[model samples]
Target: MSEQRETRQRYNEEFKRQTVKYIQEQTKTVTEIGEELNIPAKTLHSWLAKYRQFEDEPIINTEKVWEQERIIKEQNQQIDDLKEELAILKKAVHIFSNSKK
Candidate 1:
């Protein structure tokens, strides 16, 4: 019987930092990026944790990510409000036009 051992791949600090930055960009989900880069989600999460732990590192700003999420939420709420207003106006117009006929 033959026994085989698996070898682990090592990544440098620079590569890890860049990967963390890429994740912060919010272009795609972690799962999608992991599949594309052939990296495990757990590894990517570990890199993110380390990146966030050191505040002095300027490679990626976690604040920016949170701010972007806030802005998106506000914009979506505004869109919903506008859509509701539009529907109400349309109904009012329909009712008024029918009364004249």
Candidate 2:
């Protein structure tokens, strides 16, 4: 039998701080952000708790906030497109049914 070793990941202080800041600014839960970023929720939670100690002088990255906004805008646009497509399909169905009647 062969034994395998798992390697642990290391994150820098700036990355940790930015992640904590993201969690604070975004509406997403810690688990959701962790899944998106491929980080563990527990790690993110710990970073957030550590940063909370200096809540009076929190780090705010404008570029990250803008990036998040762009992503949200794109998602909203995709949702709108899906809704329009659904409406068109429903109308087509209604027309087909009426024609068959």
Clashing pairs in 1: none
Q: Top lDDT: which candidate number?
A: 2
User: Candidate 1: which stretches are off by over 4 Å?
Assistant: 1-6, 53-101
The deviation in Å at residue 28 for candidate 1 is 1.0
lDDT, candidate 2, equals 0.85
Write the residue-wise lDDT of candidate 1 on 2-100 in tens digits: 332345668999999888887877678888899989999999999998874444344556898888899999999999999999999999999999999
Model 2 ranges with Cα > 4 A deviation: 1-6, 53-101
Worst 10 residues of 2 by lDDT: 1-10
- The whole-model C-alpha lDDT of candidate 1 against the native structure comes to 0.84
TM-scores vs. true structure, each candidate: 0.46, 0.46
Residue-level lDDT tens digits of model 2 in 24-86? 878888999999999999999889878754554446889978988999999999999999999
